[model samples]
Every structure is written in structure tokens, then in C-alpha cells.
Target: MSTVVYLDRISKAYEKKIAVKDLSLQIDSGVMFGLLGPNGAGKTSSIRMMIGITMPDSGTVNLFGQPFTRESLKRVGYLPEERGLYKKMKVMDQLVFMGELRGLDPAVAGRRAHDWCERLQILDAVQKKTEELSKGMQQKIQFIATLLHDPELIIMDEPFSGLDPVNATLLQDTLIDLKKAGKAILFSTHRMDQVEKLCDAICLINGGQAVLAGGMREIKSRYERNRVLLNFEGDNSFLQHPAIADYKDYGGQAEIQLKPHANAQDLLREAVQKATIYKFELVEPSLEEIFIRTVGEKVDA
Candidate 1:
């Protein structure tokens, strides 16, 4: 795949504080890439530099095989983390205005905005003032605006915020559709479950740098500890099976850590023999766990 966006040695700072330092990454075309981190980990700063909202103090941002330029804005859609919408303006009007800002003509923008409103299931709210809509509705509206111009790259920050499950699923489906249409997407979010479900690749940012980055499957495989989760209904004493060396109880299930060469199936066999096993499966570390392990507990300034 071709590189859609590339950041080479990118660095950003505000006054005496560094936001991003020596950050480098290449986003492949047509992949749903996630930028994940804690609140002040520079995810937003890195995204800002990519979209030309802020220039890097040092380093290069290349968009679509060329230096980042004003023209590239036309091919990119940005849904910022900080929500911004004209309070008094109608939903349709706001979307149209945003499309125009993306260089689309009024007629085309209006047409596309209408289509987007319908697709997002918010056509009925088109005439309502931005402030009149519920938080989830407003989020959907902004999401529509981001894609109104039909850009090739969609960059989003906290795209799931203020959204209910139904609406969030709608947005997720829409993203999948966009991916099928060959759009490259970069999103920053704290919703690890959503990231695990949606992203093809991810970059874990920490302390102004990437602590971990790679394809979802590859990263998970690399972090696999050959652990197993088990649930049994019979005697609880069976959990004391000698085969399991490390265990952490999580509700009804136990996260059992197997020995270095201990076969997962062997452990399961022992577990079943000792108790009536209700559930037993090998598991991979969650993204949250990986993030904490890789980034550590030190808070960045």
C-alpha cells in the first residue's frame, strides 16, 4: 500500500512544554489507523500537525506523497476532539458551510450535505438549530460535515464521544463503508474496545513518542503471554490446580498465567478433570493492558 501520510522526526511544543518529540510514522493508504494514548500524550498535537492545523517545531509532514500544503486540506476530512458548531445555525447550514470551507461549491455542498444527513439518519434534524439537537445528534452532525466533501482521508479525534450505542454503531458502520471505498482513516480515542474492533493498525503514543505501533494482529501476537481464561461451576477448589502458577480472579472468570512451556490445552485438561469446566479459552492481552505495560506509570509533562 502507498503511504497516505508520513511524519518524520516530528516535534511540537508550547512554551517550555514539549507536546511531541521525535515522532515518526507512516500511515498506509486504505487502512484504519488509530492513535491511542492518555489525555496529555500528544495525540492531538500529532494529529494537528498532520492536518496543517499546527506546524511542527521540527520535522516534516508529508500528505499524499508531497509536502503538507493547503491544497491537501481538500482531500482530508477532520473531526476535531474539541466540538465546534455554530450554535444558532441550522444543522444543514453548518454542514454546508463546512463543505464550502473544504472548497466545495454551495450547490454541491448542499447536495452532499443532504445525502450525508440522510445516510447518518439525521435528515429530520436538518432544519433544527445546532444547539437544539441532543449531544449525540450534534456529534452525528459534525461527523457528517467531516465527510461532506468526500475526502480520501478522514481524521477524527474521540469520534465516539457523546454517542449512544446505536449512533456509535452507525458511525462505526459508516467508517467501515468508507474503508471499503479505499479511504485512509486516522482516529485518536480512549475507547479501547472500539479501537480493538475497528482499527486495522494502531500507534500507541506515550510521553510524546510512540511506545508501540503495528498491525493489530501482529501486535497482539507479539504480546501474547499464552494465558488462559477459565470458568467452572463445580468445586472452587479446582481452581487451586497445581498446573496454574499465576492466577487473577476477575468476577466469575480467572485469568490464569501458564508456565513458559506449559501447554494451554494441558492446563485446560487438568482444569476440566478437577472441576466441571463451563468455559475455557486461551486469551491475548487487551490493548489497555499492553498500553499500560509499555508506557509505564510515569506521567508526562
Candidate 2:
């Protein structure tokens, strides 16, 4: 796959604060890359630099494998966190207008807008004024607008912010399909669960620097599968086994955290002897657990 976006040691700062520091990552075609962080973790700052909304103080930004240029931006589509729709305009008109700004002919823009609205199950809202729609509907409109011109690189910041579960899942499926069609998608979100499910690779930022970055499986592999979930019918005394570090018991079930390099097999053997073990499974650290461990704080998500 071709590299769609590249940031080489990019750094940016305001008068006194560094917004991003020596951050670097690349997104390749047909890949879904998540730029994750807490609020004010420089995710937005890094995105702005990627799309030329703001210039970096040091290092380079490359698009489609060449130096950044206005021409390159035509191949990019950006959906910012904040909504920017013209509230009075009809949905179709607004989407067509956005497509035109991206160099699509008016007729082609109108056609694509209608097709996308139909595909997204929002055809009935095409003639509705933007301000008349609900927040989720408006968000979907913005999403459609972002893709109307068929850009190769799609950047979305908190794209699922106001969406309901069903709509969010719809958009998620859409993004997966886009990735399959060879679009390079870069989304910044606080939703680790969503990232774990959708992203092929990720760059997690904290305090203006990457705290964890890699393919999902590779990153998860770095941490131990020291957590265990148990279900039993009898004695809960086995929870005190030497291999266990800490655990929470809820009557017949327990969620356990093992001590570093603890032997899970020993704990399982003990658990079985004390109780009729219905289930005993050792699990890897979840993405959220790794995030908190790396960032040293709970995620707002």
C-alpha cells in the first residue's frame, strides 16, 4: 500500500506551551489509523499541522509522499470536531457546495450527494434545512460532506461525538468499507473501544508526545495477559492464591489482576480445588488498561 500521510518529527508550539513535540507517524492507503489522546493532548494540534491548518515549528509534513502543498490538500478531506455547516442551507445544497469547493462539478456534486444520502439512509433529510435537523443528523451531514468529493485521505476528529449507538455503528461500518476501498482514514477520538475495533494502527498521544504507537495486536502483545475472569459455584477462598495480586469478587464471579510474572496456572489449579470452576480464562490487558497504564491517568472516555 502507498503511504498517504507522513509527519516527520513534527513539533508545534504556542507562545509558551508546546502543543506537539517531535511527533511522527505515517498512514498508508487502505488503513484506518487512530490518533488518540485525552482532551488538550495535542491531537487537534497535530491534525491541524497534518492538513496545513497550522504549520509546524520544526520538521516536515508530507502528503501522498511529496512535500506539503495546496495542491495536495485537494486529495484530502477533513471533518473537524466543531461543526461548520451553514445552518440555513438545505442539506443537499450544503453538501454540493462543499463538493464544489473541493473542485467537483456542480452536477457531479449533486449526484454524489444524493447517492451518499441514500446510502447513509438519510435521503429523506436531503431537503431539510441544516438547523432543523437534530445534532446526530447534522453530524451525519458533515460526514457526508467530507466524503462527497472522494478524497483519498479522510481526517475526522470526534466524528461520533453526538451520534447514537446505531448511527455510530453505521458510520463505523462505512469507514471500514472506505478503508477496504483504499482510502487512508485518520480519526482522532477519545473512544478507545472504537479504536480497538476499527483502527489498523494507532498513535496514542499524551502531554504532546506519543506514549504508545503501533499496530493494535503488536501493542497489546507488549503487555502481559495477567488478567483473569473466573466463574465458580462454591468456595471463594481461592481468590487469595499467591499468583493473584488483586481481584474483585461478585458472588459467583471474579475479575482478577495478577502480580507481575505471576503464574496463572497455579492460581487456576488452586481455584479448581476450592470451587467447582465453571469458567477460568486468562485475558490480555485491554486497550483501555494499557492506555491508563501508559498515560498514568484515567481517560475521559
User: Which candidate number has the best lDDT?
Assistant: 2
Pairs of residues at least 3 apart in sequence or in different chains that clash in candidate 1: none
Best by TM-score: 2
Candidate lDDT scores, in order, read 0.87, 0.93
Q: Per-residue lDDT of 175-271 in model 1, one digit per residue for the tens?
A: 9989888899999999999999999999998878888888999999887566777887665665566667778876567888766666777667666
TM-score of 2: 0.95
Q: How do the residues 1-301 of candidate 2 rate in per-residue lDDT, one tens digit apiece?
A: 9999999999999999999999999999999999988789999999999999899999999999999998999999899998899999999999989999989999999999999998889999999999999999999999999998899999999999999999999999999999999999999988989999999999999889988899999999998999999899999999988888899999999999999999999998888889999999999998888888888853432
Look at candidate 2 and tell me the lDDT of residue 7: 95
TM-score of each: 0.92, 0.95
Return the lDDT, model 1, position 250. 67
Give the clash count for each candidate: 0, 0
